[model samples]
Target: MFVKNGNCNFFSQKLTFNTLVVPSQPIIAPVGSDVTLPCQLDPVKDLRDMMVGWVRHDLTPGYIHIRNNHLDFLIDQNSLYLGRTSVSESRLQQGDMSLSLTRVRVSDGGKYSYFKCP
Candidate 1:
């Protein structure tokens, strides 16, 4: 069997279906400036209440961010993001996983990973 989503795309033969996701392009900003990373998901099934995770690659195991509803959950083990990280979505319906980073620093220049689920 096949399934169709909001974009009217057809999936021909998969035993299980995972969420449709899109990667946000990397952003460049000057020191002390603000930066926003944009990611997206399509046909989110039922995202009325889902979980979103954002992470950054590092020397260590990396950082794991959990955002649910209107709350932000940054893994306590990672001290780099202690209190300088935040995520927001103006409209989940429109597939917005834009993460806002304030006071951008030279150390903050790196590729970040993001994931969303319903």
Candidate 2:
């Protein structure tokens, strides 16, 4: 899948697959501000029953957030992000898999990956 100008082009052999969308350029946010890491699934489908995970390779334990069974589960989430990450419920159904990181800190700067699983 490729996204340009808020439009997405999807190509796949399977009926269901995960397609993550990241910005073409790096995202910069001031310390203490909030930032949204953009991601989505192409050929959009309802994700209420799937598992969505966000991770940063630079962080310990990696996991930033995980959603499953229509609920946010944090048992394996990193302590640093225990209460600071979330996905927009209002937009999830529309294929929006973006992560909302609040009260950003300097250490929060890094590459993130979004995962979707059946």
Write down the TM-score for model 2.
Answer: 0.81
Model 1 has a clash total of 0
Residues 1-118 of candidate 1: C-alpha lDDT, one tens digit per residue: 6677887978686454645454445567898887667655555443326777677767255664567776666654256556666655455546566567778778777777777665
Which candidate number has the best TM-score?
A: 2
Each candidate structure's TM-score, on Cα atoms with residue i matched to residue i, is 0.64, 0.81
For residues 1-118, write the lDDT of model 2, one tens digit per residue.
Answer: 4345546665545464556667899899999999998887786777777888899888788999999978998898999897999987767888888999999998888888888888
Clashes of 2: 0
Q: Which candidate is the best by lDDT?
A: 2
For all predictions, the C-alpha RMSD in Å is: 8.1, 10.1
Q: Backbone collision count in every prediction?
A: 0, 0
By TM-score, how accurate is candidate 1? 0.64
